[model samples]
Target: MYFTIRPARPADVHGILTADIAAGRTSPADAERFAAGISAAVADPARLVVVAEAHDDANAEGGTGVVGWAKTHHWDYADGPAPAGHYLGGVTVRPEFRRKGLAAQLTEARLHWMWERVEFAWYVVNAHNEASLALHRRWGFREVARGARFHTVAFDGGEGVLLSAARPQA
Candidate 1:
């Protein structure tokens, strides 16, 4: 449960992919595309990709590696409510690392980052993903809209809900 959150680096791409696969959010066949996306996010100033690395003393190198990751994208609101703002997506934690609060930590970090850059931000969760929906609500995100037919890299024609939160008062 002891982990550090930081801006993602290119070196963390593999670990991110590993976690995604371990969590059943992605497949090995998508590694190439996922790597490309990670690389692009690392280089894009408008995007925020962060990784949580836990201490791994067993490794011969005696270092930490990525166990979870979350990223935000500049969304134009072409499909959901709100004009244009940052959209939180691609949040995943390794199966073994679940229930340790790492997801909340990563989300808070991204929210803080978005707060300084945008007046509002959005998050999307599958309608069936109760835990995520509850977590977002706990972070002050309110449901703005729900789509009966939603499609994404990980899901197709599924129920999705859009949630929005404003920048916290100073």
Candidate 2:
């Protein structure tokens, strides 16, 4: 199968959200909010959002459609004074598209984008998500920290980890 990867555009937000929801990684409302955030991120060159497109069949116009996405944020690692690093999150792939190497491609591209500006790239994965943990490991992302209050939404809280992959020196 052929894959086309590229930096996501503001107009791709809805398609991205749809893919995320289809993967069962996020709710409709959460995906909507994330879509808006993605648009804003795209407007800022510092933020990186990448997508992978795969063709459903041969001889199709556009050839492939969006199958997955990865987002990296240029934000502070800590609320207090400290050197800030790129935080990558919000990775999602359609259920039908899983295990097809799309996520890894998107990840590598996003990390490359991050390497251009930051010293390190980090990501948070829910502790219960063994699949994500394994994927991160396979990509050379090491665990940097662990915590219970890793993320909070409304009344929901979950355990997660901070993982980082070394970026090639320019």
State, as a TM-score between 0 and 1, how close model 2 is to the true structure.
0.82
Pull out the clashing pairs in model 2.
none
Tens digit of per-residue lDDT, candidate 2, span 20-116: 7888877876866777777898788778888888764573558456789988777645632212667776678888888888878888888778877
What C-alpha lDDT do the candidate models reach, one value each? 0.81, 0.74
Winner by TM-score: 1
User: In model 2, where do residues sit more than 4 Å from their true spots?
Assistant: 29-32, 80-83, 150-158
Query: In candidate 2, what residue range of length 10 has the lowest lDDT sum?
Result: 147-156
TM of each candidate vs. truth: 0.87, 0.82
Clashing pairs in 1: none
Candidate 1 lands at a TM-score of 0.87
* Collision count for each candidate, in order: 0, 0
